[model samples]
Target: MSKDSETPEERRERLRQEEWKDNLGGNLNDSLNRGNNGSLVDLVGGLGWKGTGILIIVIVLGFIVYSVFFR
Candidate 1:
């Protein structure tokens, strides 16, 4: 049915579906490209496999440093 002939509920549903289709993968791509520095989720999402590996190595080294010096 044309948009003008649709009931309010049907129009809302149709628009919602259209919005979802338009934004498909857009949010994921945006989040991956523009990660928030303060958010761990964003950080991990933004970092691909290699970056995540390096991050894990850095965390391990940092923990070792703290253990050796702070304790």
Candidate 2:
């Protein structure tokens, strides 16, 4: 239970939980924690070159479909 005995990850988790608890509302907690896992740039970077290319292709195709039909 002592902070001195806890590992780094444990300390980080404890801090995050404390932050969540001290918030005024659930929305503030949600928004604050939303980017804990990183953002879109992180996602693309994590996907590597091939995966990023595939994702781009999929997005372009989706856009084409939406443009042709919705417009």
Candidate 3:
């Protein structure tokens, strides 16, 4: 089929292949098997103090706003 006659799905599949690579940069299997991969220290410390603080403040503000406006 000619380029102009290509279906929408064919064009999308071609572009998606170009945009997204199937290759993994490193060994995902080895990383997941590590014991501490999903620990609480990893979870909390990943956010750092500043990020955690800001997230708490934002959630508090959201709750306040919801209470005032919606309830």
Candidate 4:
């Protein structure tokens, strides 16, 4: 449609709709990134502490058992 044929109110509404769509897309992206980052931090933190503790405990127990039996 020609710009001259479109009413001012229609033009304004169209522009507003475009702006709303753009903002919505941006907000969705931001929310997804935030959630992903939070999940990554939680995963890393959980593994860092729990994994290390379990590993250390297993290693120490293994060493003790080996020394007692094999020595």
Instruction: Name the top TM-score candidate.
Output: 2
Candidate maximizing lDDT? 2
Angstrom error of the Cα, residue 49, model 4: value is 0.3
Candidates 1 and 2 compared by TM-score, better number: 2
Alpha-carbon lDDT, every model:
0.74, 0.77, 0.66, 0.73
Per-candidate count of clashing residue pairs (backbone under 3 Å)? 0, 0, 0, 0
TM-scores for all candidates: the values are 0.42, 0.46, 0.41, 0.34
Writing each residue's lDDT as its tens digit, candidate 1 over 1-71 gives: 78788976576567756876789787566557556435564466578568999999999999999999999
Ranking of all predicted structures according to TM-score, beginning with the best and ending with the worst: 2, 1, 3, 4
Taking the tens digit of each residue's C-alpha lDDT, what string does model 4 give over 1-71? 98789976577667766876779977677669878676543454457767868877998999999999999
**Rank ordering of all candidates by lDDT, starting from the highest:** 2, 1, 4, 3
- RMSD per candidate (Å) reads 13.1, 8.5, 13.5, 19.1
lDDT of 2 by residue, 1-71 (tens): 89899976577668868877777697475666765755564576568679999999999999999999998
Instruction: Give the Å shift of residue 1 in candidate 3.
Output: 64
lDDT tens per residue, model 3, 1-71: 77688876576556645644554443354346546466544455568678888988998999999999997
Tell me the lDDT of candidate 3: 0.66
Off by over 4 Å in 1: 1-39
Task: Kindly give the stretch of ten consecutive residues in candidate 1 with the minimal lDDT sum.
Answer: 33-42
